[model samples]
Target: MKKLFIMLLTAFVFAVVNPTKSEAKVMYDGAEVVKGQTGKMTFKKDIKVYKKNPNGSFDSLVVKRNNFFKTYDIEKYDGKTFYQMGQYRVQATDLVVFKEVPIEIRSSFYNDPIYININRDNGMGSYGYYFLRYQLTFLDNGYVDHCFSDGDEGTDCDRYLGTDFKITERIEREYGMRYEISKNAEGKGVPLKESKTEKIMEKGSIVFAKGLEINGYLNVGIEGNDQEYFWVPVNLLKPVGDK
Candidate 1:
């Protein structure tokens, strides 16, 4: 009987280890878009996203894209498994709401911007730079599927339904984050555009979602020394089109 119990314990351990197979959870937000191979997109190049204070200063420091995707002609680069579209992609709690979270700030170098900060972090919501930090949680929901593109939040900072409109929780804690924000380097804030397709992605076609959080579009500002504020969003797009 003791031996049988040990065998059952081993099975339990294995079952727990493979929880993704049993968890009845969606993996991404529905509004997010993806191009390229569609599977787990790769983040080969080192990228950075940031949060700006009302005073026009960067108040957040969120992500640093891994370099594997950049060196090779990899299709996906999201720091996880990469596969083809319609294969392993999923729709989970994507889209970010202007909610509150903790944060810290630092002076922006190069005299171009202002400050940067540490926003929220979670495996769900947004991935690397896909989180919303403290001080700025007033806008409505924005797409978060395309880790390298913008979200659906509109500009002007109006609060509305969060990205996960499906979430019925009375008080959810969704946030946004970004990575690498330096001028001497290739910043990843170039307002991403739609480039997905039932057709294949072109060799040089800029792949991304029309979400407002993409580079150059995220409405942020500089507030007090490292103070936080809700960033503005514009729209959500399909990686292939303006869905």
Candidate 2:
């Protein structure tokens, strides 16, 4: 009876220690994209999709370039990027990164032309030379009658949106529309023309939606306008919440 018990114990220990390679579970490091961030995917060649199981070895599907999809929730495995698309984990390459647009100046200010007269006596007799300089005007439009300058006051000053307005959220995932500013950069609320705008929003397109804390602003494609971009308030944007 003692010999039989010993043999049974040895068999149990060997079975537990010597599991098959296929039965061994593989562990992966955990990583994910920042919550609520949007990402675009592009691939140079066809890629295989895998299940997010412990082994992560089973092939579930194949995704070609023509039908590549975007990934909202991303993870990293073995130095490759993976997204939780559909029911399985899809590996993605050639990932395009979207950076947050930063706001530079909060309060609105405009450029004003200033002329200075300098009398320099460089041994060639004193003569006045006129030079131009720009100064920042910090007062709100309604408060001041006109722009103040050394030689001129009550002159028209270019108005910019006050800094009180902010972008509460961004609309990422959804297609963004392309536009052209109706007027020059100084024209904040210029009306948009339907003819010059692209109906569909492309990747990296800038859009300021309405229904925000303040009205959103956007310029899809400005026709003949020298300005690359203009700030507009958008209040009507609903972006995915912070993940």
Candidate 3:
């Protein structure tokens, strides 16, 4: 087996907005809400974009109905009408993409900074990842990428200050099959703040069996013990079977 430096890049979650103009409420934590952003939403397609309108209203962004990586514009609303704009939570039970990434055995604890030891059960530092300033941004076609664009504005590298962490273990949706995450709570990995002592990795498999929780929107990365170079989002290791 080839050894890979797993980066565990952070998943970019775009804000979903509710499309309704009248009263609205959020049903989920908004962490994985799709079709609507957290806290509130607006079906008010008529509302102009926030700062683009010459009239100073919510100037609706114009969106190309394509997923082309380039030629996508998201920062400004050109002219795409929203269907919804509030939190639409996706529980672990609701996980549908079981095979897009590795199955981390820990909680994300998103939206805050945390401290963890990456030392795996067998002394492998597979879980010790770190991040600099990793903010989220959406493209015109809805593909969210880690901030820090492909090019520089000028001499500035646009280097934004970010956070760092060390964890004992990590758990994430299994990548590859892109199909199912176990609906059985007993089989499905636990969520944030939950700790377990059972060893999760097999004898020969390279795994991060510990748990680490970081608060609020983190930029994920993993560093090897050699500290040569860190990687983001381990490219190999997709889901094997079910959750």
Candidate 4:
């Protein structure tokens, strides 16, 4: 009985001292870590990129600072946050992640408008209609690519537009302000004033307009409608398109 008790105590001590791999505890008392975050990041300074070894260690040096890489996953290990780029892992502290803001451009005109002309007939003796559509792709480099289709065929023109413009001053659309068509003493239309209702345009709001520039203002459509446009100060807009 004494030999059996000694063997049982020894087995319990071995079990407590050497736990199985599945029973091992991972200790982490760091900040909140997020996983599965995917985005583009640029190196803030020259840093080392590492790859995990088969023995659960990241001692393998893949490469040095390569400037930019697209992150596939974000996770925390050893109380440090790492961004996974393919098989490589980078520390989050040595990189600047580009967080994309939600941007929406809505038009008061028709949504995905399509125009059909039944008068056109193809060589196969089947009538076809024309489809007109416009698309805007916002690039990461502060530029927007505008693509529009012609009424007859397909895409007609593609151009890049600047989107770093901000409203500098308060723009007010005054109501009850009328001008007479006939010339007055000043050789210009006579202005008639009445009680005005002000529609204030918010300052510091980012805006994009047409490429047409006249005087010191840009011709901006009211709601993506080309026929109705208003003028905005050109000095407030800084073009950041590729030269």
Candidate 5:
């Protein structure tokens, strides 16, 4: 009995000390968009759509066949390749016809500017600066502030300008191709290029203004500090008052 008790205690201790690592869940494949690539696909037959749960399992629902859906990226799950829709995944075997659609830039900034509220927190709603013909660079977190020092004291300083406001027009100047400034041997400021791309705005965040569409990206103006515009996926942004 004592030997058995010892073995159980050792197992418990080991399990507590080095728990089994949970499987990593990937939401997107981070695939680069090639020129003229299309995301529109038609379902071959009625298929079950799978959405990954937070606990590493999947919940499925039936989607009618012959329906069309656009996928942004590819995903690998359970050794199977799946196309990623907004929140749903369909297996590659279910798709039959692929269609090419011309990229469209639909903006209402001139008639009526759309305002949005970023629903993400904890560094998720952060944005970057897009340098034309150069690269998009992520800014440091310290440079961003949700509330400005205008003698307003509230959770988000909504009283200052309110959470919903129209994004101002874009400033017609180029953001130099550098993430930060560095001093050279002569004490002159040098621009250092950053290779890290910024994270996409979380779903449910608001898009205030949209400018141009190129290669699945939209030049958007969002609500935040640092008076400038940024580029994000056209599908990721939703107008204000949308569920």
Candidate 6:
């Protein structure tokens, strides 16, 4: 009977010393974690996601920057910290909290009513070449107006007097890689050729009439003029009253 009791005690001690997989809990560093937290991430370039193993090595996962995964747990393994994002592990430095800010440009011309140049850079080289993407000039009476000139040098006969419009939505639209526009939210996907001649606000000048945010673009009315408007990109247009 004593030998039977000793055998039972030995088995219990062995079971206690070697816990099964079902008895083990997830651990960070040397401490046990019951649950994890969550966070967001953004990237500038494509990156690979990795899965950690018990042997302190990583296995590649078929994930990239386009994959959206929120991290839930933070763990330290092999002296490096990683975010437990979903079922994958990613280096903490690889994640970022992103925010987009609008770009602003001021008129370089010095006059009572300055000529606004709506020029965009060709996607090439350092700084690239600039040509007028849209046209605007001061009227003979110093009234600001939108004008058209073929390429850069031509008669400014084609003119549109801007008018005040309403704001609905404003979105950041990109052209090539260097230029961005404030596209109207409502008129998206409808080709501009089918739309009316609305002045798209450029990076160099503010010559439009109405400053209404229709879609993702801002339709701003020219100062003192109610007949013409410039449709500027919401991301590039400066706030009103910002000197």
Q: Backbone clashes per model, in order?
A: 73, 20, 64, 0, 0, 32
Once fitted onto the true fold, the runs of candidate 3 whose alpha carbons sit more than 4 angstroms away are 1-37, 42-45, 49-225, 229-231, 235-243
The TM-score values for the models, in the order shown, are 0.16, 0.22, 0.18, 0.23, 0.28, 0.21
Q: How far is candidate 1 from the true structure (C-alpha RMSD, Å)?
A: 21.7
Displacement of the residue 183 alpha carbon in candidate 3, Å: 31
Residue 180, model 5, lDDT: 13
TM-score of 4: 0.23
Deviation in angstroms for 26 in model 4? 39
Residue-wise C-alpha lDDT for candidate 2, range 1-243, written one tens digit per residue: 999999999999998999656632321122222322223354556666666556655656766754444444344324454555555655544532322111122111113222111112122212111112223333534211113444545455433222111212222322233332222233232222111232333333333322212113333333244444333323222243222
Give the alpha carbon lDDT tens digit for every residue of 153-204 in model 1: 5343322212221111011211222222222211122212211112222232
User: Candidate 6 lDDT, tens digit per residue, 1-243?
Assistant: 999999999999989998665745543333333322233455545777777688988887655554445444343334454555676766756344321110101121111211211111212111111112133443444223444455768745533211101111222233211222333322212111223344433444533323233334444444445565444445665443323
**Model 3, 1-243: lDDT tens per residue?**
123323222212222343336533312323232221112222212222222345654434432222111110011012221221111221111211111110111113232322332222313222233332234322344222334444656332221111112222223332222211122111112221222322222222222212232321111221122222111122322323333
lDDT by residue (1-243, candidate 5, tens digit) is 999999999999999999999744322124323322235567777777788889999988777777766664443324454555667876667355544322211112223222222211213232121122111111242122243245556344221111111122223222222111111111101111111334444445444543344333455544553454555544444444422
- Residues 109-192 of candidate 4 have per-residue lDDT tens digits of 223332211211122111211223334455667444445667778775433222111111122322212211111111101110
Reference-based TM-score, model 3: 0.18
Considering TM-score, which of the candidate structures 5 and 6 is the better prediction for this target?
Answer: 5
Among these predicted structures, which one has the highest lDDT?
A: 5
- Give all candidate RMSDs, comma-separated: 21.7, 26.5, 23.4, 24.0, 20.8, 25.6
Better model by TM-score, 4 or 6? 4
Question: Model 6: which ten-residue window has the lowest total lDDT?
Answer: 101-110
